[model samples]
Target: MDHDLALIVGLVLIILSIPSIIAAFSDGHAPRVAAFTIIAGGALLVWAISSKPGGYTISDVPDTFVRVVARYLP
Candidate 1:
């Protein structure tokens, strides 16, 4: 559960960073911040998924997401 939460957060961060990365590249500006964010998020996500004895599968994501949302939002 902890790993799932961290993975989800990292994924969301990586997803959110996409727009910033694209904007920086499109505007010919430095993408340092966005790039760093993407890298960090990716690392955390990888670490979280790998930390457990058995890594998660694609099918686990949706349930994890819903569980996290329910836990946090409710």
Candidate 2:
């Protein structure tokens, strides 16, 4: 994957995890779900960092946008 894409993905994951982390702290019933979200988000971020290919390319593709949308809607 392109480095730019990877960075975008990682940013997306970190962004997604923010709400989950907040929910985990504010709600009782959502802790488990929140925890899972946080873990999954972290994993995705790590994967993006480790999987990025050589020199990054700049693009306007929607991978991160889609991932963020999916995280909120799913």
lDDT of each: 0.88, 0.60
Q: Which 10 residues in a row give candidate 2 its minimum summed lDDT?
A: 52-61
Question: Residue by residue across 1-74, what tens digits does model 2's lDDT show?
Answer: 54445556656666776777777777655567656765666665567655765422344336555665666575
- Residue 72 local lDDT, model 1: 91
Best by TM-score: 1
Clashing pairs in 1: none
CA deviation > 4 Å runs, candidate 1:
none
Query: How much lDDT does candidate 2 score?
Result: 0.60
- Model 1, position 38, has a per-residue lDDT of 89
Query: Could you say which candidate leads in lDDT?
Result: 1
